[model samples]
Target: MNDEHDSAFDSVTSWIVAALGLLVLVLVWGVIFTFTVYSQALGDAFGLSSLRLSSIFSITTAAFYIAGGTIGILIARVPLRPVVATAGAVFGVAIGLLQISSSYLGLAVVFGLLGTAGGTMFVIVISLVPQWFEQYEGRAMGITMAGNGLGIFVLPPVWVWLLERTGIREAFVVVGGATVLVILVAAVVYRRPPELRAQGTAPVDVAWLRSNLTDGRFVSSLVGFALLWSWYFLLSADLVGILTTGGISRAVAATAFGIVGGVSVVARVASGEFADRIGMRVTLAVGTLLAAVGMVVLPWTGTEPLMYVLLVTFGIGLGAIAPLFSPIIIERFGPANATAIVGVFTVAEAATAFLVPIGLNLLLGVTNGYVVPLLTVGGLTLLGAGLFYRGTAPKTSPQL
Candidate 1:
């Protein structure tokens, strides 16, 4: 009887982990691919220059600041249906509306209004990971980060294919339509475990959120991540253009994107596993430096083949940054307040996304090409690395 019960318990545990894992997969795809693919299309349609392209996606990214916690609250209060389905609605509606879009307002409405809505769905997905694997939260988050890589790997070739044949609008319809289906599946799969719900108190503390956000060490994490995300998202927003301008063909550039996504697949998973086995402070520092190196190298390589190799390496290095973000929060604050703190950090990062890309555009206006912008990204990266190192350094006791 004892053996039978143990076996059944293990089976159920396995199922819940798998369900949580799949939920994370959809969210990761939504995060890494959807906005980026939209950014590419948005730029093409409006003659909206690359800098303003960030504006196109900025509203949705901005909404995460407000909505990330709201998503957690919804999951906390109701069954997972409302939170998950609402997210699905945003994704599906955004895609369906694509058939009607023709101008900047439409792009802003769908990408910003609807796209922001779609993106906010991810916070709920991530917030549930701790509920499923309380002690092993970091490892679970690492496992989940693979979803982003998977999306990155498959999405580029598919998006490039869609863009080439059907034009960007129809591509939206197809991708958006597919998103609705996944959203439904995501809604069904993601939930806070009953074990957590039975405890009465919420998984994370409300008071802690208020304290953590204002604290110095935590704020440093946010600032550091914002800089990291700015460059990471900027790369996603501009990869095709970057490679093509460096003399690689469009087909080759798209392949390079796929290569990045494929590498990111490993980076996300590896980063998480590395963090869990190692420590958040060290792992994040390494990711920041790798991404910094990746950002700087893109502008220097002269040959087409060399650009391809370096850009893919850059993508792999750059792509793994997000997985470390929540781990940093969890390590500092514990899992209970992870969502709220992460939401705040994400908001700050989104603001960086808005400002930095436009700033790069201005730099281009002044200097032409990516030389100055690349230099600026490298400087910010080094600055970010320095901040992390200093913040995490052993506090020296004041000299007696």
Candidate 2:
């Protein structure tokens, strides 16, 4: 009876907790989607060359990730909600600055420096739930993780349309205004879980992380994650151009990406729940294989039916990866150091995100097209699948 009672309560709390995390993700990505669109327009307004425009995204992205790692460390030491609120305030200011500044140098400073200031807040939200909830981690993480897609779903079209009507300067003001409202909502509800509250101090278990580094399951997970992210970053930064070159129009490309982003919300949740019911290794391998299939078809997908099929296929895989990755941290590292380990992982992710996109840019610079780049993404994901299979613990090996 007590067990049943505890589980019922746990279920309720978990859903609520996940919902809070999801809300934070939505607003974070909402601002992020809008920011990226606005920055691109700012570059266009000034007649910056393609190389110069890419540089702004490159710098903003690089700084965002490197800072994300540091922000994770900070969250481990501080109250989680305050960090988010502070980040929100800074994000608000960064957007406001764009309203006044129009030069490339000005955009770089505001986005690169001021933008990075509120950067960690979103990272903390994404990272915290994994530590707080363990057993239902995937489902919870998936639901919360969907917040990003939710924003992508709701925000991008709105952004494009708004920018169409209002222009870039006003877009910045609107994006910043939205951030202020959402962050305030998140700040009030995004508290640490009761389990962590019982402990008081943040979890920082060094031994667990050291164990994880040596453990086969954890290592496999890392490799798989690296592959997954490499593909994701590559596509995210280049999708519009890549598909368009294949003969799709810019308007169609935008709509396709918007649909892809929207579909991710459902995909994230389904994959998370599936992982919980089955196991992370099996679920991830299956999801990744499907993602690889989509990659294979992407370059070849020219006709309308095939194009729509590939779009949904690619989204299905991309959406599932994140929720699966985040919620498992506590299982390996424990509550203590969960955030710190995630930070280290973020540092790794940040590096991959920067390099992968930069690498794509270079490939485009040389080849003037995306064939090789798309092929690389598919190949890496398959390679990662093999690496993951080999890295799993032997049935005889003791579990970490």
Candidate 3:
């Protein structure tokens, strides 16, 4: 009877963690990615150039992962509730600061704050879900990450409506406040499992990471992540711009972008479940390959219908790839090493987020087309797929 009761309680708590994790990703990643929708509005308001506009996103993204990886070290050793709550407070306030900033530098600084806090919250939320379940870990991670897809899908249209009605300033104020409130509530409710809470682990150190470097699997995963994220950010930084420039209406382009996110919602759950059956290595590789194929063909698609179809393909890969990061890491390194290991991958992600967009945008300026840069994205992502397959643990490996 006691065993049954414990099992029931664990089931309830696990789903709760999944639910909150979903909510957090919706707001955090959703708000961040919605920059694409608002980039035009921001540019119009500030008289900014494309390079300058991309820089704002680059700054935020780079800061986000860099902070996630750096601060994640500290978080591994400390109590989580206070740190996450403080991060929530900081994220909401920084977003609110966007309303008053008129200058490029000011906006960059403020967004850097948003990225830092959001990154912290994001990593924490992602880290927590896996601790709750062993059997459905992939699915849980997928479900949680689907919030990102949902947010991207849902928020753009909402932001469009809000921007039209209230303008960007008021939108920021309302949305920022709401984000703060939700994160605070989640922080209060989301706790580590008792088993995890009871473990008194030491902070991860450089020497330990150095030793892990000797493992080819670990290094391969890191390299694959960096390359994969480079491809992702390359597209993200300019997909809307590509559509608009291709003679598609802004509304249509936004819809296409949302299509990617919407499809990703399904892909996230499906890929997670599929990974459980066939193995995450195969799932990861196939997803990346699909995205690559879509990306390679995207520059050739002149019509709206084809663009939408290709984006759906890309979305599946996007959804599948993002959720596997933690699962793969935890599988190889163990849960105790999960947070710190993820932080290292976050650093790789940060490098790509910071540099890839800027580089691609610059390449676009030189080439006067998306052809070369996008082709580069496709090729690199294919390489990423191979690397992930090389690095990921096979299904036959003993479960941690």
Candidate 4:
């Protein structure tokens, strides 16, 4: 097994396949995250209120996060290739279903399916990277997770061009078909880590999960993750609105938001390497602190230049979180249960995704200004960073 692991580590084929997996994740999440751009068009077509439109988006994101737990369970009991391929197919089909959706309810169902498929693929692919590289796990996961930032940056413009040229329904069909084709082909290239091939059937460890749930460190990490993730989702959903409300022009606000995405691409890769060298805990704390600072200064930025500075700060910090999750879990719990633990963590993230935006909206209503809410979120992010720092501290001794 050691020899097999060595052979697979940094092998040419494994690296190429890992790159393809990154591409797959990019395409999958690119489509999902672009929902922010599409929501307006969807609202116009369906005569939906902003609240209803937001609810639809929330449903998809929540579904994606919640599905991670079930995906973890399935992957533990089944082979990787079949499960991943099936998820890709389902995702492709779900995207296609969006083309013919006539009612808001119908679209919600399709998006829900799409979210589930995307979530399952995300869990499997992230888990697979650790198995492929021993020394470069953080770097590999960083490269792979960078896809999320890339998708957020790249997809909106592409979708906008498509929507302008092809119109909404036609754009859906064309993009859906193309995405499906790529997913099916990528599925063939994805292979399990060589180390796991000899282990005939992976067993589901229910007791391990129960004990982990009871662990103080794990629970603290989960809460911290939830807080940071909530901040991420809230920023994504409301940044443009926040900027526009603060008297920034729409075009400038949108470009500033785009800069966040662009800066994040660099931030993700750089932080990954840094994590590998220094440590994930230190990297994550620094990133979260940057995000907190950005959030605190966000509402006060009065010019485009200041906005860019704020966003770049926040984006770099936000970008670091995704790549760190798998590595941190593996370090804390061991590889055997990393996927399961991540699944539970993802579900907590999903719950935060659902509640944060709504809670912020209510906060804004009560305060009649963005300052208080932004400050509140920023404070929570800092608190999360502190909790994570505490949770990851070296254990002093056996408690019992």
TM-score of each: 0.73, 0.81, 0.85, 0.88
Number of the top-ranking candidate, with TM-score as the measure: 4
What pairs collide in candidate 1? 60-116, 204-336
Inter-residue clash pairs, candidate 3: none
Better lDDT candidate (1, 2): 2
Stretches of candidate 2 above 4 Å error?
1-14, 39-41, 44-52, 113-118, 160-170, 197-220, 240-254, 358-373, 386-400
- Give me the displacement of residue 308 in model 3, in angstroms: 3.2
What is the C-alpha lDDT profile of model 1 across 318-374, one tens digit per residue?
A: 544656556555545544444455566666666776777688778888987987788
Cα deviation of 310, candidate 1, in Å:
2.7
As for lDDT, the candidate ahead, 1 or 4, is 4
Error of 4 at 62 (Å): 1.8
> Model 2: per-residue lDDT, tens digit, 225-278?
666667777777777777777887787786776677777788988988888789
The residue-level lDDT of candidate 1 at 219 comes to 61
Runs with alpha carbons beyond 4 Å of true place in candidate 3: 1-10, 38-54, 95-106, 165-167, 240-254, 303-305, 358-375, 394-400
RMSD in angstroms between candidate 4 and the native structure over all alpha carbons: 3.1
Q: Which model is ahead, 1 or 4, in terms of TM-score?
A: 4
Ranking by lDDT: 3, 4, 2, 1
lDDT of candidate 4 over 1-400, digit per residue (tens): 2445446676665576568667867777777778878777778877889888887877777778887556765576566667777877887777677777778798788888888888887777777676677677778878888888788777778889887876666776766666667667767765556455665443557776677678888777778888876567778778888888877898888776677777877887888899889988889889998888888888887777788788888778867877887767666765654466667777777777778888899998999988998899988888887766676665773432
Return the top candidate by lDDT. 3
